[model samples]
Every structure is written in structure tokens, then in C-alpha cells.
Target: MSKRGWIIYNGNLYTKKFAEQIKWLRKTAETFDFEIDVIANNQLLVAMEEGCARILTEKQKPDFVFFWDKDLFLARQLEEQGVRLFNPAKAIEICDDKALTYLQLANHGIRMPKTIIAPKVFVSLEDDSHLGQVIEILSFPMVIKETFGSFGEQVYLIKNEQQLRQKAKELQHKPHLFQEYIASSYGRDVRLNVVGDRVVAAMLRKSDQDFRANVTAGGKMYRYQPTEEEEKLAVRCSQIVGADFAGVDLLFGENDEPILCEINSNAHFKNIYDCTGVDITKDMMAFIKETITE
Candidate 1:
């Protein structure tokens, strides 16, 4: 019997981008003779009864799940049901929260930009005094990002104290982080797609319109070769995050050294494919097949 799997994406996203990723994953699975089904996260209901977990979907469970959504509960429930998930639940949790990702990587001595976690604030309480310390450490021209965001949508560049305070106040209720901005890496970064222990493809992204080098942010991409150090760092990050595969973004440090930016557990490969002509979906499927067999 051929191995079977399900590729789960966020149905609520309702964007062609998310659908595009699923299309590629399904294509790869077909090539490997693996029966793969594409499903939405919300399509399955997670139920708990008498200390037992069950998925309420009518579809039968597959041998594994290629989870491309950030619904932690659904991911964990699937894991509890003995359905192995690509990148796993814990990996998805850590990577979904920027603060947690940084903390875990820092524990392993990963080199990243200096980051400070924002303190939680209640909606009724208004205060910006605590952020003064952040200003002292990171100064102006810092990067502010929500703990949970993607596609470069909720990131901000604070150029002065006023902007810093305003951004802080706006996000006081949500978890966020502040980091030093690497001038050298402004609007430019490298994205390495790592499958298992190896980087299968890489693309350098440069933005002409904004500080974020994300392709969704109007950045351009080009096929590029990664330095040995860069490759090692990307793979190491994947291991640290407990990810079977990841999209690791590295900022340019002084003298072109690599500094960790962020890791995406369900990174979209369409742009990378267009830029590098390397389809990581195939490597991902192969890795999944080998891992499940092992």
C-alpha cells in the first residue's frame, strides 16, 4: 500500500498564495506515489472527552499530516491521534511566536539581532514609561514586530522616540519585540529553505520600497549561493526549532556575516521557486517519505 498524508493549510486565509503552496505539495506527493489530501484547518473540529482527544472530521486519518497552518490546538490534537505532522506541533508553536523562537535560539547561542520582549499590558491600563529602557538599549531606527505575524504585515520600523512610543502604545495589548536594526541589512536578506538537515534552495531578497525584504512587501528575489556558515546556521536553526523543514531568513551582518532574522515553519516556496528555479516541494516530499519510513 502506498503511504498516505494530508496537507493542511489555513482555510480562513482564503488567499491564492496559501492555495498555491498546497498545490505544489500535492504535486510532489503525487510524484512520490503518496496519497495526499489537502484540507483546511477549520474543516476539522477538535474535541476532548473524558481526558481523551478526538478529531471530529469525517475524513479518516492519514499516515501523516503536512501542517501548513498555525492552529496549534488542531496540530496538537492531530499529534495526539498519532498522526505525525511535518515540523511537528512544538516546532509550529515556537516558530509561530517570534519571542519564543528567539528565546529558544538564544538558549542555543544563536547569533541574532539584539531583541527585547515587550511587557504585556492590559487594555484599561495605559503606560509607555517601561519602553524607555528599550529606547536606551536599541535606540532609534529599531525594528518592532508582533509576536505572531507573517508576510511582513505587522512589522514596523521606528525611527524616533515618538514613533517608538506610538507603535508601542498601539501594540501594548499584544505581545511584541524590539530589535536593533542592522543598517547593512536594510531592505535585503537571504532566505534559505532547509529540508531536514540540508538547505535545498536559497534566494536573496531585496526591497526597493520598504525596510522589510519580504516578497509580499514588494521585494525582489534572485537566485544566490549561501556561504558555508550561512548554510550551517540555517540548518542549525531548523534543528533548534525542532522543525523538519523551515524557511530561515538571515540578515547581513558586518562584513557580510549571517545574522538570524526569523524562521518560518510553513514557509511559502512559490517565490523562491520563481527566483531560484529550485522546487523545494520535491525535497520536502522526499524527506517526509524517508522520515515516515524510518
Candidate 2:
């Protein structure tokens, strides 16, 4: 019998872009002669009764799950049922939170920008008590990012004390981080698509309008040839984060050194495909095939 797989995505997200990616992934898996089903996360119900967990569905358990959503609970439940997830549940949870990602990488001595996770604030406090220490450490013209966000939408660049204070106040109810800005990498960064300890493709992103270099943030991408150091760093980051595949963003630091930016367990690959002519879906399927056999 042929191996079966489940490609899980967010059901609530009704965007054509997301649908298109799923189509591409499922089609690629089909070309590999695997019977793959694209299922919505919400369609499957996770249940726990008398300390026993089960998925309340009539469908048979799959050999592997291609988890493309941030639903950590669902991912964990699937793993508990003995279905292998490509990046694993723990990796997804860690990468979903900016603070958690930094904490994990700190012990590994990775070259990331200096970052300070904001203290938890239950209520929106009126004063800027926490801002004093943060401003002193990161200074003005720093970057403030929400703990949980994507596409660079929740990241803010504060130019002065007032902007920092205002942004902090606005985000008091949310988890955030304060970091020193990399001036050398303004409006520019490199994205390396690493699959199973190897860099399949890379692109340099630049923006003329926004500080964020994410393509969704109106940045432009071009084929990039990563340095030896960059390739190693990207691969190492994936290993440290325990990700089977990841889109690792690197910022240009002093002397053209690579500074770790962010890790995406389910980063959209459409743009990378357009830029590098590399089909990551095929590599991903191949990697999964090799992994499950071992």
C-alpha cells in the first residue's frame, strides 16, 4: 500500500494565497505517488476523555502530517496519536513566539541582534516604568516586536523616546520584545530556505519604503548567493530549533556578517520559488520520504 499523508492548514484563513500554496503542496505530493489529503485544522476535533486522547474523526490515521498552521494544540494532539509531524510540535511552538525563539538561541551563542523580552503586564499600566530600562539598553531608534506575529506586520521601529513609549503603551496588553536595530541592514535581509540540514535556495530582500524586508511588507527579492558562513548559520539554526525545514532570515551585520533574524517553520515558499526557480515542495516531500523510512 502507498503511504498516506495529511496536509493540515488553517481553515479559518480564507485567502487565495494560502489556498494556492496548499494546491501546490498537494500536487507535488501527488507527483511523488503518495496519497496526500489536504485537511483543515478546524475540521478535525481533538478530544480527551478519561485521560485518553483521540481525534474525533472517521478518517484513518496518516503516516505523516504536514502541519502548516500555528495551531500548537492540534499539532501536539496529532503527535500524541503517533502521527509524525514534519517540523514537530515543540519546534512550532518555539518558532511561533519571538521571545521563545530568542531564549532558545541565546544558549547556543547565535549571532542575533541584542534583544530584551518585555516583562509581562497583566493590565495596561499608565506609567512607563519598564520603558526606562529598555530604552537605556536598546536606546532610541530600536525595534519593538510583538511576541506573536508574522509577515513583519507586528514589528515597529521606534525613532525616539516618545515613539517607543507610545508603541509600548499600545502593546501593553501583548507580549513584546525590545531590540537594538541593525543600521547596516536597514530595509534589507537575506532569506535562506533550509530543508533537512541543507540550504535549498536563498534570496536577498530589499525595501525602499519600509524598514522591514519581508515581501509581504512591500519588499523586493532577488536571487542571492549566500556566503559559506551564511549557509552554515542557516542550517545550524534549523538544527537548533529542531525544525525539519525552515525559512531562516539573516540580517547583514557589521563587516557583512550574518545576524539571525527569525525562523519560520511554515514560511510561504511561493516568493522564493519565483526568485530562485527552486521547488521546495519537491525537496520537502523527498526529505519526508527519507525521514520516515529511517
Candidate 3:
């Protein structure tokens, strides 16, 4: 069996660093006589359609496909055609949906922050069946999050009762989640980078006066050691979510219990590298190569 793979990415492949990853993978793959292809979205759906169709017809197709969010429709179409996806479509879907992640984690006894889901078009506060539950379990200064939010951009802090109600009123047509703000995270959270079943590295992110510690939000990160519990949680989440390499976000609760925030299906490695000096891409690619060569 020849070792071969493909990487799906956006037009950002124009950057040298992006190409380096593909180049490195290809070189490493050649040791096993593997062929690798990198497809970018610059030419629209051409790469997706051609790639997906070829894999179905060609006997010598890419053994593994690593994806980084160019288009979901394209991704799904390829998977439906039986292309071997790195993180299966189902796993990506679970990680993308906050409500689903919570449900899965809770079912498996993984501790996570308190989360509440409201329909996109929530008409009124009193019209919620789960409103009572939120009121009972969540207190003021809670966090209102958009389920599909990324880079900590769509997170809002509802500092007072009025702000929560006001934002809720404005978002009558949009879906959202209400999570108990563990004021303890205090604009800081732990992100554990997991590669396959092992944790490559971990870091603690701190935001300024804000509750969200995402690096994009003027936040700083420091080195961190994943506690046994955190490491287990990271591995469990990676296995369950099917992420080859990802960052698992967690924070300490009032009781010092680890509460999961969310898991990144396609995490940003630059931040992790700047903080921890770990080159996660090399390890991520190594796993697939080793598996294919084996």
C-alpha cells in the first residue's frame, strides 16, 4: 500500500507557511513512497469536485484527507463519496455544535461549564421551557454565547440582569447559549493540545478584565501542565470528537473542578507555539504518516 494524503485548505495557501506544512508532509510521506496533494479554494469548487470524484474512481487515491475548513458542503460531499476523512464528518459536526458537544460530554460524565441553548428565534424570555432551569442554575454575570462562534469573537458577558435581558431581546431571531460564568476563570482558561491520544502541550490564557481568554482578544498565555484529570479529559474529548490534533478549552470552576468550555476542531497552533514552544503540526502529520506506513 502506497502512502499518500491530501490537505484541504482555503486560499490562504498563498502564504509560505501554509505551503510548508504541505511540503513537509509530502517529504515525510515519500519515505513511505507516499504522494501528497494540497488543494486550495482559490479556484472555487474545482478542487473539491475534482478531488472528491477522483478518490471515488481512482484506486490509488489519497489514503487520508486532512481538512481545515474551506467549505462544509464540499467536505460533506467528499465524505459521502467514501473519501477517508481525517476527522470524520460526524466528529466535526459534534465539535462545531456547542449544544451537541455538551450533550455528548455530559452523557460521558465529563465535567463542563453550565450551558443553556435557546432557539435562534427565541421570542421572549418567559417563553422558554428551559428558562426556569437557567434561572435556577445560572446567576448574574453569566455568559451568552453564539453556538457557532469562533476565536472568542461572539462571546458576550451579561454582567447584570438588565444586560442579559436586553441582549436576549435583541437576539429574538438568533440562536444562543446561556452558560454560567465561573467568575473563577477570570478571563483565563486552560487549552490542552491533544494529538491522537496524547497531549502535546498545554497553556493557560489570560484576558484583561474580560472573561474570554482567547488570544485574539488581547489575551496573554503562559505555560501550563495538564493535571491528570485535564489530560484524561483532553484525550477523552479527542477520541470522542475524532480530532487528530486539537485544543481542548477548560477552566476551573468555583470549586476548582475542571469544567470544559469547548474543543477546537481546527485549532490555531501559532498561539500554542508562542506560549509552549511545541510544533504541533509536525506531530499531527507524523501520526497519519506512521499509520499509513504501518
Which candidate number would show the highest lDDT if scored against the true structure?
A: 2
190 in model 3: Cα distance from truth in Å? 1.0
lDDT accuracy of residue 159 in candidate 2: 97
Residue-level lDDT tens digits of model 3 in 1-294: 565677777775457765665565556556655567776644335234644442233334457777765366666766766667766666777787777778777778788777888765634455545555666778887888877778898789887767877777777656678998888888889999888899998999998867788888878899998789889988898787777777899888887678888988877677778788987777777777776557
Name the candidate, 1 or 3, with the larger lDDT value. Answer: 1
Q: Which one is best on TM-score?
A: 2
Q: After the best TM-score superposition of candidate 1, give how far the Cα of residue 197 lies from its true spot, in angstroms.
A: 0.4
lDDT for residue 62 in candidate 3, whole number 0-100: 56
The lDDT for every candidate, in the order shown, is 0.91, 0.92, 0.74
Tell me which of candidates 1 and 2 scores higher on TM-score. Answer: 2
Candidate 2 vs. true structure, TM-score: 0.98
* C-alpha-based local distance difference test score of model 2: 0.92
**Model 1, 191: alpha-carbon shift in Å?**
0.3
> What ordering of candidates by TM-score runs from best to worst?
2, 1, 3
The parts of candidate 1 lying over 4 Å away from their true place are none
What TM-score against the true fold does each predicted structure earn?
0.97, 0.98, 0.83
